[model samples]
Target chain A: MEIEKPYLLFLGDAPDALAAKTAQGIVDWRRDWCVGQLRLPGCLADTGLPDLDIATARARGGKTLIVGVANAGGVLPPHWAAPIVAAIAAGMDVAAGLHMKLADNPEIAAAAAKHGRRLFDVRHSTERFATGKGVKRPGKRLLTVGTDCSVGKKYTALALERAMTARGYHADFRATGQTGVFISGRGVSVDAVVADFISGAAEWLTPANDPDHWDVVEGQGSLFHPSFAGVTLGLLHGAQPDAFVVCHEPTRTRMRGVEHRLPTIREVIDLTVQCGRLTNPDIRCVGIAVNTERLSDEEARRVIAETVRAEGLPATDPVRFGVEAIVDKIAEEFGLP
Target chain B: MEIEKPYLLFLGDAPDALAAKTAQGIVDWRRDWCVGQLRLPGCLADTGLPDLDIATARARGGKTLIVGVANAGGVLPPHWAAPIVAAIAAGMDVAAGLHMKLADNPEIAAAAAKHGRRLFDVRHSTERFATGKGVKRPGKRLLTVGTDCSVGKKYTALALERAMTARGYHADFRATGQTGVFISGRGVSVDAVVADFISGAAEWLTPANDPDHWDVVEGQGSLFHPSFAGVTLGLLHGAQPDAFVVCHEPTRTRMRGVEHRLPTIREVIDLTVQCGRLTNPDIRCVGIAVNTERLSDEEARRVIAETVRAEGLPATDPVRFGVEAIVDKIAEEFGLP
Candidate 1:
């Protein structure tokens, strides 16, 4: 689903900053794409954009109202309907990352229909995708894989996109999750698609491009995470990445939300190459992205150094350190100038 | 979705038996659950059941009309709608494995609503499932893993279920595909569910049971298959089978609908165990099931014997021979008497 640009992020009655993490993510990465923030009275969360009403945001060239907050049950609160309908009435499209669709609200649906405005439900895929063909497609691709869920896969990819583009390489960040979709403005929420179409959706998201161009594709759940490894494998196959960066959280003892222990980075690389060879024969690990937020500066450096020595690849905390080293490794490995 | 018993198989103007293979599968597996066949004019397919009109089938105590034939383009022909409506009017729920939902047809929806009848769209899941938790549940489970798609996974599981039951062990065949669902009378079409819930749906299908009772789960796709490995992986994590059988087709040249070549039986066993260990660390291969339809009787026996020697597991053609050897292996391995 392709959402319009210059969004007015709707932070509806969010109780804390964590509740509006999606909005915060957009603000963190693509602050220029956001026109303003629209929050209800009880909302305690903030994206720190200029607060504006629907009319003001629309006048400022906001083409979409992004409902980027998570309600307690992922539901659309009854009171938030008015502002969403008002945005639609004002000729702006609406997009949401909620479990519930925006069009499910009667007021929002009617307003969109009357105004000929679109409602993008990013969590629900409206695209009908054919099954993945697994045929080799043109273009270079790099995917970010994780040791576990929420282990900086998206951040690593987005950072790579920025770094590679700055270094005169043609690159685009391809998204596979809701926040990533809103940031990229066009992507399929791969997990939300039917089980049969996981890889198919990923294939569609990263179609054949120029031979030298790179699709820095965002990844999802770890291959060892039982809850979501299917999504991770499908994305891995569909992306057919020539190079991948393994994202890891060193402090985590167990996989997120499960009893299974996190797999070692070596294990992740071995299995990824084994399975990824189906679509791309030359799939290889290029670097490591460590999420060392919980570690001190000395510990982070020690971990990164140890990872580099052990894996024999560039390693860095994408948030704490820039992705320039990894970009340099990609250039050297792929013979890019 | 749980379909009612005594189905009236609807073969709507199918030009050949291949088009009505699903109906034929139900007939072959569960003849007692079906009342009779309902064929439209010009139908060339037959399950060798008594021909019956809608009224006659309903009179014979058919509770559901199974639209078990695939029409051209997976669309319901306009001509067949009248009979479907008539069947609903006669107090029978309708279940179909078509790509298009039954309720999408206005006439069928109206008829079902008017008669308080239900519509079962097997290709479209209406069941909400949580993400798989990967927690071990109590039961003895055996899953069929395939070297490729359409390699007799379902048949192997069903055969094992029958054999184990006749040997005085409590066993149930858990369906994961369309035809298996019809034959078993209940199961979520795991591939049709949202990608995030593939394992979750499988867990629900084979829930906690008696320690010795076996849930013989039907498998889909293969770990080596490019288009469907995600579903296969999710099923592996979710089913957490204590023992598995590798199903192979002896004469296949490549993986189904893809350019990649098939993996060896050893590769399938190794990978299924490697990935399946996330949920069930005790996962092991008990046997091998080969589809020997294209082979001569002597060739089939030779291939089976070779497979037994190579893999050190019980091997047989479930269709040509029987699953008795596999059942014996399972009984011995699990101390099931």
Candidate 2:
């Protein structure tokens, strides 16, 4: 599902900044793709994009209206339909990150049909994927795995793409979640796919590419996470990365949304390689990306230093320090430019 | 999804016995639950049950008409609809093992609504499931883990259930696939559920039972299978079996539908234990269940003996030899009467 570029983000009466997290992610990663933001009255969220009406967004060459804000229940309030319908009527395609489909709303569906515009429900996949073949496809892919959920896997992957590109390596961030999907403009939300096709959908997302070209694939739930390990394992098999970075959160005691204690970074690496070798025998952990948001700078550095010493791999917080060390490790390991 | 008992098996113009495999499976496991078979003209399959028309089958206390045959493309032919509708009109609920929903056919939908009957598409899950919590629940569970797809996992679980029950244990066979659902008369086809809910569906299928009762959970794809390890892992976590049997095929060299070597029985046991330990800390392998259909009697005995020596556990072809050894191992290990 290739979404049209230069999107006009719709933040329809979202209550807070977290509600506009998807839009914020798009702005953070691909700010150039966003033309502006369109907010409904009483909307408290903002991505700091220019405020623009439908006609102004169209005039400014916006091709798609992205419903990036998520309200309670991921529902599209009845009052929010007016702006979406207006955008479609103005000949702009619409994409949404909602629990319900935009096409399920009659006004939005009809307006898109009448104006020859497309409606993409990014939360739900309409794409049919074949079961994963486990074939060794051409391409040097690097995936970010985590010890638990809500780690820095996605951020580390996006960072790797940027840093690897600067080091004269061809790289792209392949997304597997809703926010990453908008940032990359196309990707299957693996969690939303039918259970049997989890690996197949991941295979489709990052296919055969140039041998030296790197697909910095975003990861999902950790292999240790009982709630979502299936999605993580499927992504690992389908991506079949030659190199992977283990992402971790240093402060969390238990896994998110469950009673399970967090697995050590070493355990994550061992299990990933054990399972990942089925598809890519040469798979290895290149580095570690730790989320140190709760730690002070000194503690973050100390923890990262201990992790690096313990695992014998480069480790850093991607947000505070760039992933240059990880990129260097990749280059040395994979013989990349 | 409690399907009413006393099924009327519908072999609708099936060209061969292989096409009616689902019906044959149900008859093999639950002969008493089947009233009789109903076949259309030119049908080539028979389950050895007495033939009866829809009215006669209903009169004989058939509560459900199981469309338990697979045609090319899994589509319901137009001619097959008449009998299904007739059965519904005769006041029987209809359940199908087809790819498309029974209600998708307008004629069948109308007939069911008019008669106040229900339609079940066993291959598709309409049930809502919560995410799998890694919490240990009350039950003695045994799961069948395979080295590859179609390696007698379901058959092994069913065999264990029957043998254990006859030995004075309260054991139930929990279904995870389409045919097993038909045989058990209720289950969510786990593969058809959304990717995030694979484990959740498994948990629901084998909820907390009496401490001494066993839920003999049927497993799906292999943990070594690159194409489907995700499903296997999720099932392992969700089932949280206290004991598991490793199912293998003696003659298969490669994993099904993929170009990969089959994992050894040792590999399957180790991986199942490593992953299964997350939900059930005491998880361990009790035996090896081999499919010896391709072997002679002497060869089957030799293979089973070799497996028993190598794995140091009970091993047998459940179909040819019986699961008594495995049940004995379980009873001894758990101190069951």
Candidate 3:
């Protein structure tokens, strides 16, 4: 039975009046889209008051679950069984909650396990807007790059983005994984939660919704990134980008008396290629984007060029190569342009 | 000052003959002693390996540098100038080649880069042996558990290890990071060339120094595994351990995501805790260990009760209570136990 409207509940620590107002905003927004009425449960009626019955939600079913722990200006206390139980009782297949502290509690964990619910921990609400399966374009072009955490992925991605835009192709940047914003040309943590949400939501949206936008999604962190790896791989598999751009530095050193070996840049590229082939054989490797930190530009260029050529690939200016060049190459290779 | 040992050159795949011979029972075992000699040029060797460059070594001021591609393999062609030039003109540095594939068409990369040097990628002949740090007796005791890879960290650490262990004394299971075998295991890999030499000269002694031992040594994966995170932190920071045992799971799922995430587990734990403390200051935590797929009665009991809890901690079972129990009752209540 197709229920036209899904009910959403907002539980938080905000003052009753303000919290109710914010809850009203959510309800209004959803109502515009013909989603069923959004309501604040009376269990959270008091402003600046703690409700222990949040667990009671579990008894209720078929309702959208949304709980804002920040309304209390802190994490949920250990006694949050009531409201949590309620949510579980409600037959929530998926339950998302704000506040990292929830992960540390055993009772909530047990409740989640008992209910067989997946918890989406949202650190930034903005990112949530973009989470979901994006519309597919069979022959669409895309690129991806990664490195160890704090290894200059954003800088390299942004530089590549600017280069591509300068080359005069329609391009837009989508953060495929975790990313930080640059303020005054310096990286600053904006809102990882929001960014993640947006990325996720964008997945469900079609490129046709916004034509003329060629997307270059940035992946955060190295191969082992908890969320990044799964999300990036999923996007690549689903979106089926025509080509890939790998950013790497070959001069890093390993630790002493330790043997946790990382696959080389070449190895990573090869694995990506293998995965790409398995997913979509038509996708081709365009080139590599190498960050020249210790090496001078001339040295970096020469070494990168040699390495690329050795791998049987055409090398381009890593600093100057952008989205347009990638699109052009993909078009030329695939007979699109 | 040239030594009579005629600087042995171990080239080709599996070049560390001495290490191989040692592992194969060719050499007598010694603790905390180097098994081979590495001679660095007053300046770095020219065109022999990518990591042995004289200029780079000089730049680091004669300290041993652990530089190499994380999983470099195969041969190099003559044309590859950057790495080759860096290797040959060396000062005092150890360069070990593993799975390097630059031997074919090496000249093309070098000539293209306009660097002139006779390059030969040679493997190192040294074998590193494990030396236990010796038993530590801290003011307070902490038990650590770890697996080779993923292997049910949260379950084993909190459920099994902490539950049976936390009694009588003040104890807790706090996650520090993901730990692996290579970073904490014993043994080393011997170069193939060294193995050949030992085979010809010390055939009688080869059984003890097998290459398999070397591979095992280098195979340890993490120092800060999630299962082992609590224990590793205690070990490094002088938290005494009454006893410690690693949980071994034979399944591949336990070891699957380890390669990429193990190295970063330490950082993640630290960040999570610090982030948590910023909002709330009541979290208490202690040591941790691994959860094995199968455990002998003796091993299981020892891990669950004696080894973990013998120190007379406050809690009876930590695994049941989860991280909150450790944080509130242990971390915030005590200093370091």
Q: What RMSD does each model have against the real structure?
A: 1.2, 1.0, 28.6
Any runs in candidate 2 off by more than 4 Å, and if so which? none
lDDT score for residue A303 of model 2: 97
Task: Give the candidate number with the greatest DockQ.
Answer: 2
**Model 3, A1-337: lDDT tens per residue?**
1111233444433445554443343333233321222233443433232222333433333344444324454466444545555565555532233344444567667777887764444332322232223334543445564533344444444554555566665555544321221101111121232212222333432244233345555544333222123223334443445566766665655311222233366755664554444234666676666656678778877877786667665544444443345445644664442
The candidate 1 chain A region of ten consecutive residues with least summed lDDT is A328-337
Name the DockQ score for candidate 2: 0.86
DockQ for every prediction shown: 0.85, 0.86, 0.01
Please write out the lDDT profile of model 1 over residues B151-240, one tens digit for every residue. Answer: 999989998888998999999999999999999999878899989998999999999999888999999999989899999999999999
How well does chain B match by TM-score in each candidate? 0.99, 0.99, 0.26
lDDT tens digits, residue span A1-337, model 2: 7998999999888889998898999999999998999998899998999999999999999999998898777788899898888998888999987888998999888898888999989879999998999999998899999999889888899999989888899999999998898899999899999888888998999899998889999999999999899999999999999999999998999999999999999999999999999999999999999899999999999999999999999999999988999988998998867
The weakest ten consecutive residues by lDDT in model 2 chain A span A67-76
Q: What order do candidates take by DockQ, descending?
A: 2, 1, 3
Model 2 lDDT on a 0 to 1 scale? 0.92
Q: RMSD in Å for candidate 1, one decimal?
A: 1.2
Cα deviation of B26, candidate 1, in Å:
0.6
Which of candidates 1 and 3 reaches a greater DockQ?
1
Ranking by TM-score: 2, 1, 3
* Candidates arranged by lDDT, highest first: 1, 2, 3
